[model samples]
Target: MRFNTAPAPHLAPTASTRRIMQWVLVAMAPGIAAQLWQFGPGVLINLALAIATALLTESAMLRLRAQPSRAGLSDWSAVLTAALLAVSLPPIAPWWISVFGALFAIVIGKQLYGGLGYNPFNPAMVGYAVLLISFPKPMTAWLPPTDLAATPLGLLDAWSAIAHRAGPAGSSFDALAMATPLDTLKTQLGLGRTMDEVQSGPLFGALAGKGWQWVNLGYLAGGLWLLRRGLIAWQIPAGFLAALGGLSLGFYLLEPQTYPTPLFHLFAGATMLGAFFIATDPVTASTTPKGRLIYGALIGGLVFVIRSWGGYPDGVAFAVLLLNLAAPTIDHYTRPRVYGHPG
Candidate 1:
């Protein structure tokens, strides 16, 4: 009998990167649908444009780098990054904004750093931050929640708005644009208004902003679904929310006039999204369970600090990016000890 041996051993079948990314995309669907329903058709248009631009840019870069385009595209990582970026951006922002952001994410943020696994930052957040800083006006121009709009944009109107800066329904894009709840709170706080006064405004939907609360709830539902599917673990989200809520509660209890309620901090802006999705990016976040908790706590703390003191109305992107920078150090320090090794 002759024994044949190969240089490398074959492994059993398991989940592929593409399958993981696909699940992530699926988990985002509820939030995306809710955004479309609440904010009109601009979100859908942005999603389409961003996806196209990301795929195009990814393909072009792969070809230039002498890598197989089909394999790279099949991973769905680029599409997930594009979708995340698109959802975070202002729904009514011009077509060029999404195009530029997606291209920058795929090329500069992801590829220039040697593609997905090598990138230090979350590609989607990098794109969002770039657009937010470069085009302040458009980036902050969130549409009034569907209920508040005088004339909600239809699909054709949304297309026209992106294409021409005016809707087919004869409304200027500016007319449809409105400040988000976090923006309103930040501006009001800057003006020296108390939380009570700001809460009296129509924008305050129940505990959070009006239409925005439902959007947050939708995202929360999706996040929980992801948790149930085992696509994500509970440690990150639990730690993030616990830290954020703990801090917010402490502050609000100390000074009710100045600080908003803990519920507001949890429901407003991208708190839920950041906690579940953004901060949990496998490539950019800590790997150890203990490290993940620490990482998430840091993000939550930073978010509170930035929202309360920093110039930006919402701090999810900044918080996530800052935490991403610290993830490696966190992993290094928090790695589990070997079972048979001495301390």
Candidate 2:
């Protein structure tokens, strides 16, 4: 008896990589708008600069690697990476900051490791982490929300601050900037202040931080849009938020004076963006349904641990990078059984 040896038929999905990336860009619009409203035009400028730098670096690396530069560049992966890195940085971060970040992300973080899919870490997070570590003062000098700023930075002032390295009247960017809620909380808590005291600080506001709360809300809206469009699976974000919220609630219930509430944990930092977008990167994240839940939950749990006890005020980048390292292991164990396979 002769047996037929034929390849399995390919099943078509409604979306392509390009389409997915386009949707990702569209989903970022609400967040981008919020940043613009709260922070001024600096955010848009940084995004443009970062995107240009990323495409240039991506093309250069692809050519050097003897790959098709146009094809690689057209995929918009580098653009997305640049956008994420840019948005995460202080809006008025010096020009070189975005430039160096784009270069590091495209070259060392992505290409040097054998290009996009082969890299173990998320390129954008790698770039952000490096910049944060190297330029702590500049990176942490986030602008107080428009309502809190003694002098809201105008377009020209913002431009001058970022471009000329000085604010109006010889003041520095530092004079016009304030700490993020996470940074504020970390320092105050380290100084033995209670959670209530920290929440009442100048940096804190009705929702969370002066301006950061609006930014987080913007990202939250954008993330919800992404979910509505089905660009991402609900498993990762749902699992991550559930874990983070549950853990924070447990801690808060155990000691209200010491621990921040779930709202603070959810809206204070990069929790929403990380949960909906960053942690759900299909390439770097787990693929199987079960694996995705495990991956997301692990990230959320790690985020709580890091925020509560670790050095970093915000744990999104650290948590995502750590979980990226374990994705393969997660996939191995969580693989779904074949339909006809015997258990």
Return the top candidate by TM-score.
1
Model 1 local distance difference test score: 0.89
**Top model number, lDDT:** 1
Residues 86-106, candidate 1: write the lDDT tens digits. 999888889999999999989
Tens digits of per-residue lDDT, candidate 2, 176-266, equal 7777888888888899999998898777777677777777788889898998988898889988999999999999999998988888888
The TM-scores, one per candidate, come to 0.96, 0.94
Worst-scoring 10-residue span by lDDT in model 2: 4-13
Pairs in clash, predicted candidate 2: none
Q: Cα RMSD to native, each candidate?
A: 1.7, 3.0
